[model samples]
Target: MPQNDRHKEREIPIEFDFYNTLESLPVDNRCTIIMISCGSTTVKINEHIQTVTAPAVLCISQYDNFQCLERTHLSAKVFHFDPWYIKACLNFENLDDSVPIDKQYVYDRNMLYMFTKHHGYFQGIFNLTPQQYIRLNELMLMIGAETYAQSDDYWTCRIRRMLRQALNCIYDIYVDQCKLNFYELSENSNPVTICTDYIHANYRNNISLNFLCELVHLNRTTLNQRFKQQLNCTCIEYLLHYRLKISQELLSNTNLKIDDIANQCGFKYGSYFNRQFTKYLGISPSEFRKNPTGYSVKESRGKP
Candidate 1:
């Protein structure tokens, strides 16, 4: 692979190789690393370890440590990017404020939050379906090509767009898998896990505390106490936050009407939704959609 000295720091760096590349890349906390296996292999990311076959994806946050525990018939492609690089390439402002930052590892804190809240079903390993694997592979190839080409005309914009699309693709796969696992674990998992999974799987529905209690076979008082004990928030509060988060994403990414977005996010009244959005974000949904970078949860709510 060819390297570009001019973009040695500015551009998002990607490595597409089988074995040698892994040995040369240091375990630095300056960037978030994603490793995609091209064949079946076993790997360790921090204390969590898993064995996945080809076309699987694993993400190592900037705060976590990683090592390749074992390798048999394994080939992989790895990509890493500094938080600032991801912010500049994707045009996300105040990304550091939205995500927790450390000297050791880089991460989009918002994205990691969503993954932990919604897609914790998979633990650490993200096993991709064959179709998703192919799409991600192609996207990685495009990113690699753009990095090597370093065209002065439009390559920078092209690379950013491709990188954003790849990230969105990975997110969609996680969401789909979470839904699948939700149904499969409906009968097997513990009450708290099941309740949380239910929220993730059906946040778009009009779910009330009673609905959650019935779904998880617990009474109102027990459910509330246990849920607060485990997640530090009542069931209803969690649902409200979940809806607000989804509404924020729709506002940032789409041109949908506020009312429509509210409806899609399970809010029965747009006015109520607007009030909650303003309360949590300290800005109207309209303002947030226009300039998402201006507001920071850390500054407003003092929380990630």
Candidate 2:
């Protein structure tokens, strides 16, 4: 396979392969792994074992011990990429390296944070619906084809775009599954659930840690700890992020003035809102509103 080196850095740290090509389980390094089952198989990541039937997906993070315990009539497609590749593709920073507990699928943490204010982690396995399975399979096939395409001026760019699309599909499925699982697991009392609901419902008004503590009947210290434990973020962080989300929606979907948007999204001052928006998204509200699609890293870097 040919590799592309740009500015002395690898343009894309990615590999595509088939399950039957494996002679042994490869040691995990800096790469993230995506495997789709073509038939029933049992695999172990760290100490957790999962059975994946045909059309199922499994995502393995860097440094996790993985083993295929049982395979019968197994054929699969696999994709591997490093964190830098993901960061370049998604235009985000400080991405989490921790492997989610759920083995059924993997998703981008930042995308999930933007929507849910939670690290994209979940317990239990997910089985894709028939439609989802078909869609993901088709995406993986496209990625596999691009991975081996003849090298050209746009080869790397094409692969990156396909990979990003595949990641987005997985993320959409993850979000839907997480929503259903959250309700099922919490029965409506999960700390993360309660806090997220409250933030979404009350982001237009000021929210404080003490107020959340009072509402949830937990002390300030306990509330912070549990919130972090469940969501991988502090309650206050979640509140700020949720408010920013609302602001972004307004910026994209409404002609509301910046000051009004800030106030409606719980920011006391528009200047503070602008600062936070720039800090988080690397783009000002005005810039994003003018060309929302240009906010992506690809655009910032002058790539397609």
**Predicted model with the maximum TM-score:** 2
TM-score of each: 0.46, 0.47
Q: For model 1, what is the alpha-carbon lDDT of residue 103?
A: 32
Q: Identify the candidate with maximal lDDT.
A: 2
Model 2 residue 1 lDDT score: 27
> Which lDDT tens digits does candidate 1 get at residues 1-304?
3234354455334433424234433334333334465545444444333445666766554444556644545677765554444463332233345545563434444444322332323444566778877887788777767766776656656766776676777767656756787534634346666666656655666677876676556799999787677767777877787788778788888899999999999899999999988988889999898897676442333221
Cα shift from native, residue 293, model 1 (Å): 70
Whole-model lDDT per candidate: 0.61, 0.61
lDDT for model 1 comes to 0.61
Score residue 218 of candidate 1 by CA lDDT.
Answer: 76
For residues 5-102, write the lDDT of model 2, one tens digit per residue. Answer: 44345545677775543334432433433445565665555544444566666655543556766565778777766555555433223344453433
Q: After superposition, how far is residue 211 of candidate 1 from its true place, in Å?
A: 43
